[model samples]
Target: MKSNRYIMILFFIVTLLNSSCSDTFVDDIDLKFCGKCAHTGRWTVDSLDFNPCFSTQAECLDWAKKNGYSDRGCVLCN
Candidate 1:
């Protein structure tokens, strides 16, 4: 009887922990939530190469500049 009670308690604890670890709003957050944006691959100029995802126009622009891409090459839409 005592062993059965302990088993049930352990089962309940495991179930609760598993369920609590999950969230209803747990989802992939869209890094690009700002104005018009494009993948880093699109921002190519001269011989520079970029391969990354962005969540803001500024970040893309910054990377582009560092990689030799021009602001004109980037399009931002809000």
Candidate 2:
């Protein structure tokens, strides 16, 4: 009986640990919420090779200037 109780306790602890280690969120919020105001990888803004970077006009401009890029316009909604 004592051994059975210890086994049950171990099982409970293992279950709890497994559940806590999961990367999945417990809430129902949309994944988009993580990047709501952030850049969405749309619009290239320069002569430089671009990747998904800024989420705002200002950010794009700053990036262009820092990298010596000469173009500053929206590419496509990424």
Model number with the top TM-score: 2
Q: After superposition, how far is residue 22 of candidate 2 from its true place, in Å?
A: 58
> Residue 16, candidate 2: how far off, in angstroms?
73
For each candidate, give its TM-score against the true structure: 0.29, 0.33
Model 2: lDDT of residue 30: 35
Q: Candidate 1: where are CA atoms >4 Å away?
A: 23-78
lDDT of each: 0.52, 0.56
Tens digits of per-residue lDDT for model 2, 1-78: 999999999999999999887555546433332132234554445333434455676776676667666454534344
lDDT of 1 by residue, 1-78 (tens): 999999999999999989887665466443332222243333222222334445555776787678656643444322
Pull out the clashing pairs in model 2: 39-55, 42-78, 43-75
Model 1 has an lDDT value of 0.52
The residue ranges of model 2 lying beyond 4 angstroms of the native Cα positions read: 1-43, 46-48, 76-78
